[model samples]
Structure formats: C-alpha cells, structure tokens
Target chain A: MRLAILGIGPVCALGSGIQSLRTGLQGKVRPNIEEKIIPTSHGEKMLPVYQPVAEGLDRFIPKRALRRVDPFTQIALLSTYLAIEDAGIAFNDKSRVGVVFGSGYGPTRTTFKFLDNIIDDGDIGASPTHFANSVHNAPASQVSIFLGLTGPCSTITCFEHTLSNVLVTAWDWLNQDVVDYVLVGLGDEYCDVLGFAAVGMNAGRTKDMQPMNFNACTFLPGEGHITFLIAKDKSHQEGYAKISEIRMRRDLEEVKASISNDPVIINASGNLQQGKSFLKVQQKQLKSYSNLYGGFPTSSAFDLAVGCVSMKDRKIYPVPESQKKEVKLENSIICLEFCREDEFNIYKLE
Target chain B: MSLELDLKKLIIEELKIEDVEPEDIGDEDALFGEGLGLDSLDAVELVVILKKHYKIDLEDMEKARAAFASIKALAAYIRENSEVQ
Candidate 1:
C-alpha cells in the first residue's frame, strides 16, 4: 500500500497537536495530573484527563456543527481539518476520500449521561441534544458532515489497536483503488464514571499499589484526539511522515518473533512478562517510550506520532526515566500490546 | 408513600444502585462519600432528575452537592425548594 502521510495533528493530556507530543516525547516529561472533579456519581474525584486549548480551532471547524459534538469529537473534527490543511489538501477537492477513526472508549461518557437522564428523569426529560451525539460513530459522522464528504466513513472501537486497524483498513481500501485518500483518526476522552471505574477496577486487582501504577493512571482517564492524512502517490513537502509498515497479530510472541533488530517497544504497561519477553528475544535493543506517553488505549497513537516525527528528524529518543544509562540510539521498531491476549501493533518507521 | 420516599426511589433508580430499595435508604445517611457511593457526576444527574421530576431548578451547585448527601437530605431540600405545579 503506497499511502503517504501528508500531515498529523494530535491533542492529548500533554498539549495540543503534533508539536506538543513531540516536545513531550523528546523531553521525557510526564503530563499526567488530577483535574477538577466532575459532577457525577461515578468514582472519579480528581480524574486524569486530557483537554485541549480552544485557541485556533474555530478557524478549522464550523460553529453550527460544533454545538453538537463533544470535546473529543470536536478534537477529532479539528484534527481532521488540521491534517487536511497540513497535507495541503483543499476542501474543494471533490475526491471521494474516506475518514477512518479508532476509539477505545467510544462515546461512553456521553452515552452514560444520556442514560442518567433516561433512567433518572423520564425519556422526554432526556436531552435530545445529548442523545443525538451519543452514537459511537459520531466522530466520523461529524467529520463527513464537516467536509461534506460523500465517501466511506468508518469508526473502529477496538481498544488500543484502533489506529492499526484503521490504518490497515484504510491501506486496504487504497491498495484496492477504493479511495484516493483516507483520514485516519484516533480519539479517547475521560468521563467521571470511566475514570472512577478505572481506578476502582485497578484497585480491585492490584490491591497494594503504592507507587500508584503510573502507566494505568495515565490511560484510565485521559482524553486525546489525533488524525493523520494518508494519500496515495501524494507526497508533499517538509512536515510529513509516511506510514511505513503497520502489522497486528493475535499474540505477543508473534511480535517478539517478528521484530527483527533494535526496536523501541512502547509497551502499554510496565508489565514484567512482556518486558522480559522482549529482553529474552534478543531481536534488537529495546527502548521504552510508554513511561512518557502514559498508558491510554490509544496511547500508541501518541507513540506513532512520536515515531513519525522521529522519522522526519532522523532521531530516536530514549525511555523517559532511563537514568543516564548511556543507551545507544538506532533505527528502532515500535512494538506494543493492545491487550493481554491480543498481540498489538509493530510499526517499522523509516 | 411520602415525597421523601418517592425522591429516594428516584435517586436509586437514577444512580443505577442495584439491590437497594427506596425503603432501605436511610433519610440521614450520606449520599456521597461512604453512604450511597454517589459521586459528583451522579449529583449532577440527581439535580437534573429533581428539576425534571419535581420541577425543582437547582441552579446552585453547592446546594445541590449538599442535597446529594442522602435521600433524606435530598427530599428535604426538594420539599423546601421545588417549584411543583
């Protein structure tokens, strides 16, 4: 599949867009913090969530449609616009380009609010406005509407593997000459219930978490939105990253066996089993980026953003807290696990 | 049988509290920390619930947060402030 990445935009806990992510990844900084408690019965008191600055976004998204879309969807819409602008693609281009998005906790928070209104008050009391925006496919739908695109609009809700799935699917469409371009997007947001349930669920298993399971904390309740513009035979100037090779598998052993040489594995968690397995394989040197990126399901999207930036700059950053280990940098492969059983994605960035 | 009982039932239903009936919820017990396990979001939902069911417009967030302590408290607050038609 010859899909060229024209531009990438990301809004996460760290900051807004690709530059914020790049700075975060490069500096080994941790951006997780407790925000104000939301008004919900859900357990999250001070939830760790990512919210983007509202500056410069109004120029990209329209006002009428913006009224309905939530922050996450708004971020998605903004990223799409930025990606199109970054790609130098004109909105007037009437080509049938599709938008494929991956979301881990798709519209759950919004749906939950609607559920509250329905269960608490009567159905008539439920906010028709909120109810309309609760669909899982809302981001893509809004993107389609924003661009007035009459093309294939798809949404994926497969935990963290969303980006790989969307990219591969988009790649397939491009490979088959089904579409000229695909706007691959990823978005996840924090709701009080989700954040509380996350900590509650984590506490149930790990019981004695003193250091507070930093990896899980980063993910359980953070909000992030990112988008990449992939074009066929359409390579354009200085600020672009190519989607080199995206592969997913059923288990981690396949990843271990598949990774050829010194690679950067952005393990979602600091799990010893997966960490040790990478060490045992001896395929190549492994540098961890998870500590900096945190542990969100779509966190790999952030790491992918970093990798894309690295390819453009020709540099590999060390693990955030590597402690002056004098680690050598090399052309690295990115490996990750979507879940315990599911072998995540391994991106070979050039 | 009373407005308080009715409010209690509505809270449990709204908050998705399983296994507990309206009669079981104590009037003076805490609704948030250590009592009914309701959090801030649930409190917001409760405020919306009251406004819709009882025509009580709880514009004050602080007062609503306090009312969410328990069914008894919420019922009293509702009785005092509700604009029932």
Candidate 2:
C-alpha cells in the first residue's frame, strides 16, 4: 500500500513546518544543544539534550482545552494542527479522516508524576488527570477528542520500530479504503529519566554523527513530533513525496540484496548489515541530519521528512555545506532504518 | 489566605481552569456548570485536591454537592468538616 504525503508538520529543535526543516537541513541555521540536569540513582547529572518542546500551542487550540493535557499530548495536538493546516483542505466530512500516532516513549514525565502522587499521598491520593494522561495511547485519544475526529484512531509504541509501523499502518489504512486520508504522527520526548540515562549511556558531545561508524553512540536525547497528512490522491494539496513500498526484513542478506543497485540510503545502516562487506565498501552518498535534530529512537521520521523535502526541493540538504548534493526528480530514495543485527526496514520514495 | 481564596486558587491551578484568575471567581459563584464551568473531570480533581491539601477525604461527590455549590459554601463546609474530623 502506497500513499502520497499531502502535508508535513514537524516540530523539533530545528523549528516547525517544512520551511524551517529545509533551512536547518541546508545547514543555514544551527540548533543550540541545551543542557538539562536530571536526578538519577547516582545523584544528578547534567547532559546535552535536544528539547524541541512544542511552543505556542494556545494559538491553535484553546488554552482551557489543554488544561488537563500533558506535554506529550500537547505536542501531538500541535503537530496534528500543523499537518491539517499544511494540507489546507476544507473537509466535507472530517469523520472520514483517520489518525495514527507512534511514539518511542509515551508521557514518561506524566507517569512519574502519577507515581509521585502515589508516593506523596499514598494510593488514594493519586491525581485523576495524571492517571488519565499516563497511558501510551493518551495522546491519540486526546487528539481525536479535541479535534472531534470520529474516524479510526490508534497509537503504536514500538521504540525504534515506531516510525515504520506508523507509516506502514497509515499506508495500509489508506490503501484498504478504510479512510480518505490518514494523519500519521511519530514522536519521542526527553524527560528527567531519559536525560540522566542518556548521560550515563555516555552520549558524547560530538557535534556531528559519523553514519558509517555505528559503534560511536554520540546521540544526544531529543524530543519532537513529526506528522504527515497522506492520501491516495494528492489533488487537495501539493505532495511532498509518495511512499512506494515499505519492507521489514529480519535477515542481513535479504535487506542488502534488496538494495543491490544505487539506492539513496536515508540514514545509517547500523546493525542491519553486520559483516556485509558490500554495504561497507559501496560508494554511496550517505546523508545524516542528526546534528540538526539530535538523536531519538524514532528520528527516522525526521529523515523521512528530510527525504520528502529533498525530493520536493529537488536537492538533498546535508548537515554541513560541504556534503551538499543535488537530487534528480526521477531518482528513487530508499530510506534504510536498522533495528538490530538482522532486522531492518526500507522505505522507497520517489 | 482565606479558605475561599485558597480554594479558588486550587480550582484554577489544579482543575486547570484557564483564562480566569483567582480573583475573577466570585465568592458566591457556583463551582460547577454556568458559574465556573467545571466538569466531571474537574470534579474528580477537586476531590483529590480536598484530600491532598485539606486532609478532608471525600468518599464521593454525592454528599458534597451543596458544599461545592459555591466557594463560600465550600469554605464553610471545610471549616465545619475540619472541626468534626
């Protein structure tokens, strides 16, 4: 199942919308890496993290409406609003538009707050709002409730597999004619626990990421939400890119053999090609924007966003100005995201 | 702070009733619908707030409807309940 990306709504360290994304990808603007202090088992530790917290949410949704909503749900709502605005469609029937959201972590801060309520005042003193927002599907529920979207909605929490699952799910839903359009979302948040863990994990301050060197875990924790409004027909708005095929393979040779020709490897192969000499020796134009958007498990959504934008702009924007490459319209971009030594997902876009 | 004022702040802060300041809520204004526009979720939060801050454990809102009628009423109810408890 394939769907055309009608609109892109991404909120990250680089900023919101495709313009900000394109600017950051072109290396025109640099996202400042801020320091966050988190209390861990070994006391508190300060670490570098990317806090792309959703801003000015009151502009889209009423402030009162967001009273019980947590930060995780707030970003999901904001990104959904952005995707809808980017599409610029006057829907005849909003109930037919389905929503699918994916996340690496769902409201860890809220969950911990609920736990605090339990600790401070015991089990009976737990807060109702905190308890309600602590679930993994709370964001998706909030989005549908606030927007009054009556269509089929779901949330997937699969860590690194979140982005691919979200896209593939939306693709299937649209192709199966279950809905006219599918609004897909992928997000991960940086809370206090994740912050100290990233610090203890030795997330280095390497300003750039070496895509080929998988051993160097120089990824700082980042938080953001990237959404796409996709449909079978893109006559409503200008499309960013069309998803042709998405495949998930658990074998190294199978994944490698699938992309034997010149493929636009979106991000690093990581553990997907263990001992695969062809992938290591192949002369491919590897591009990674990890410097712009920091590192989270589902950052590949940002990669896909960049790929779609690159295809739209007819130029691939590398992190530094030196790695600039012009992309042709006819070239098919294969975004390879690896999960484990023998597990990977491929997204082919033109 | 007066019990009325403190309850108003809790209602706004914990109940998350936005665009309205503590002083904006009148002493005689209703805490639920039409007066302050609080809903069932806000009712649940108010119950927790009472339990957490006032040490007044409410088993349910069925018996507290009159006390929650207004901020003044709620304050008087709390004072009366504090003495009894």
Candidate 3:
C-alpha cells in the first residue's frame, strides 16, 4: 500500500508551522542561541544552545492537560494536534488513528529532577509525578491521552535515526491495515545534563557552531518536535508528498549499493561524525536542511519536513552561503540519514 | 494556613486536579475513589507529599490507608504524628 503525507507540523528552533519554517529558511534568519553556564574543573564555561520559541504553545493544548506533562511531552502533543488540524480530518473512531513518536533524550529534565530528589533527600523524597513522566514512552502516552486516541501507540529512541525508524514502523502499520491514519512525531528537549555533556565531549573542537558548513566540527545542541499525518493514498485530500520507499541499512556498502542519480538530501547537521559519512557519498546533487532546525539526534525529522515542503513548493532551501546556488527539485527526492558509524536509513519521497 | 486547608491546597496542586479549588473540598470528603477521583498513583504521590512536607512517614501500609481515607483523617493524623504542631 502507498502512503502519503497529508499534513506536516514542525515546532523547531526557528518557529512553529510550515509557513514559519519556510520564512526562516528563505529569509536566512539567525538562530536563537542561548548561553548556559556549566561548571568545569577550570571553573565555569558557557555553552550555546538553540532553544525553541515558547510562544503560542498554550493555544494548541488545553491548560488542564498541560499541568502534569513535562515540556518534552507538551511539544509532542502540540505538534500532533497541529498536524491533525492541518490534515482537516476528524476521527469519529479515535481508535483508528495510531500514534508513533520518537525521541533522543526523553524527559531528561524530569529524570534529572527525580534523580536530584533521590540524591538530596533519599528515595522517599523522589516525586511520583516526576518519576511518572521520566519514562521514554511518556510522550506517546500523553499524545494518546490528550488526543483520546485508543489506537496503537509506540515510541522509538534509536538516537539520530529515531524518526526514520518511526516512519518505517508507521509504514508497516499502514500496510497491515491496523489503522487508517498514523500520527508520527519526533521530539527532544534540551536539559543541563545534555548540554554540559555535549560541551565536555567537544571541548577541544571548534566552538563556532554552523550547520550550513558541512566541514564545521561544531554541532549546536537543539530540541523541538515535528509531527506528520500519514495515510493511505486513496484519499481525495491533497498531500505534500507520497512516500514511496523506506529502508534502513546496517552496513555502508549496502547504502552505497542502493544509491542512484536521484536528488539526495543529506543529514549533515554540523556533526563531525555525520559529516564524515556524508562526505563519502559522491552524489553530484546534494542538500542539507539542518541550518534551519539546528543539530540534534532527531533533527532528521525536520529534514524530512523540509523535503516535503521542497516537493510541494517545487524549490529547495539550501544553506545560506553554501557552494550550491540552485536546487533542482526532481519528481522523487531521496533522503539519506547517517546515524552513526555503521547504521543509516534512506527515505524516498515523491 | 491551617493544616487542613494547607493539605487541601497541596492535594489540588500536586495531583493537578482540574476545575477544583481547596475551598471546594469538604474536610470529610474522601480522597480516593468517587470523592476526588484519585487512584493508586495518587496514593503514592500523597505518601511522598506527607513525608516531604510533614516529615511523617507512613511506612506501614495499614496506617497509610487509614490516614488517606479522608482529608480530615489525614490532617488529624499529621497533627498527631508530625513535629510541625
């Protein structure tokens, strides 16, 4: 069965919604980076991170529903709601709509809070509410509860390629006829622990963060959510793109064997590791959308969203000062994501 | 604030009870089941709140269940066992 992306909702460092992202991408808006102080052996150092804009989130979800959920879950729920509204489909049978979400660091803030309570005041001081929201599946559970969706819900956390894995799972569910539509989202939240660790790991590397420069060693930490409403291709509703193929490979040779002359969108999010693998591909036509979304594990979700927009608008949003001046949109666009040394995933969008 | 009123506010805030106020909860209203719509999870949270705020540990399940029967019972139990009074 063929699957189509009915609607796209992206809440990123740039802003929320497709139009906001398009404007940011086209206008080459400067990234909103906030400085965080982290304690080190030599004293304190400042770490720059791309923080998402916090306005207009309350409009997407009810106030009562936001009380218990952490910010990670809130972004996922809001993006999912926006995608549902964008699709313009009201599910009378809520059970027919499944939710598949992906996250790199799930509820890190709540996890740290629980840890602090336990460490400071013993196990008795740990807050049950924080403990409840610290699990990896909490975001998916919140999506099901707030949306009243009784269908199959799953959360995938495989680091950089998490969203790609989620899309593959959703594709299988649609092919199996388990649900008529699937709401797939990818989200992550910035925390002190993650930011400090990132700084510690990249201490001696270049501190200047730039996603457009594939050779840059700096990977700016970022967090946000992006959700897509996908359904079978039989609907009369217009869609951004039709997903033709999804594949995950464990070996680099297999990925190279499967590559063709198709226009490819690479996931070089200013990370040295991802850039190293991205440099291996000799494809003449290449594009990267990480500058608009910043660099994170699940930032590939934003790359896919940009690809869909490129297909719909018949234009590609490239890096501001990259060597490539023009982007020719083909009938089918291939997305190549390099998660780590040996694992990669390829997506075909038409 | 009185311990009873303070307990009501704590319950309302910690449990994220929607559309309910501390003044709305009667002193003798049950805290579990049909009274406040609390469940096992809330029971655990209530135990933490008691230990954290009042320094009264209900290590015994029976004593905890009895104290959690109602807001009045909880306030009385805390007043008797806690050093706050």
User: TM-score of B chain for each model?
Assistant: 0.85, 0.88, 0.95
Q: Using TM-score as the measure, name the better of candidate 2 and candidate 3.
A: 2
- Candidate with better lDDT, 1 vs 2: 2
lDDT of 3 by residue, A1-350 (tens): 66799988788877777667777767656556677787877678787777776456678676775777877877777788778777888888889899999988788888998898788667888887898789999988988987789999999998876977899889889889899999999988888888788777772244446554556677777888989999987767697988888887646777777677667777776777777777666566667767666677888888788788889888776654464554666577788888677567888888
Expressed as tens digits, the lDDT of each residue in A1-350 for candidate 2 is 45789888888887776677878876777665687776767776667667674666778888877888988888878888888888786556778888899988888889988998889877667888899899988888888887788889999999878888888888788778888988898888878778777666665435444445555555567788888888885545478788887887545566556664534554452222422432553446555566667677778888888888877877655544456565454566777776765567778787
Alpha carbon lDDT at B29, candidate 1:
82
Query: Which candidate achieves the best lDDT against the true structure?
Result: 3
lDDT of 2 by residue, B1-85 (tens): 7778888888888877778999999999987889999877777677778778877777755757877889988888789776422
Model 1 misplacement above 4 A: A28-32, A35-54, A62-65, A203-220, A233-239, A250-253, A270-284, A291-293, A323-332, B1-82
State which candidate, 2 or 3, has the greater DockQ: 2
Query: Which of candidates 2 and 3 is the stronger one according to lDDT?
Result: 3
Stretches of candidate 3 exceeding 4 Å from the true structure: A28-30, A54-57, A203-208, A212-214, A250-262, A320-328, B1-43, B60-85
Docking class of 1: incorrect
Off by over 4 Å in 2: A204-215, A233-237, A260-283, A320-330, B1-3, B60-63, B77-85
DockQ each candidate and list the results: 0.05, 0.67, 0.44
Q: Estimate every model's Cα lDDT from 0 to 1.
A: 0.65, 0.75, 0.80
Chain A (alone) TM-scores for all candidate structures: 0.82, 0.89, 0.92
Residue A168 accuracy (lDDT) in model 2: 80
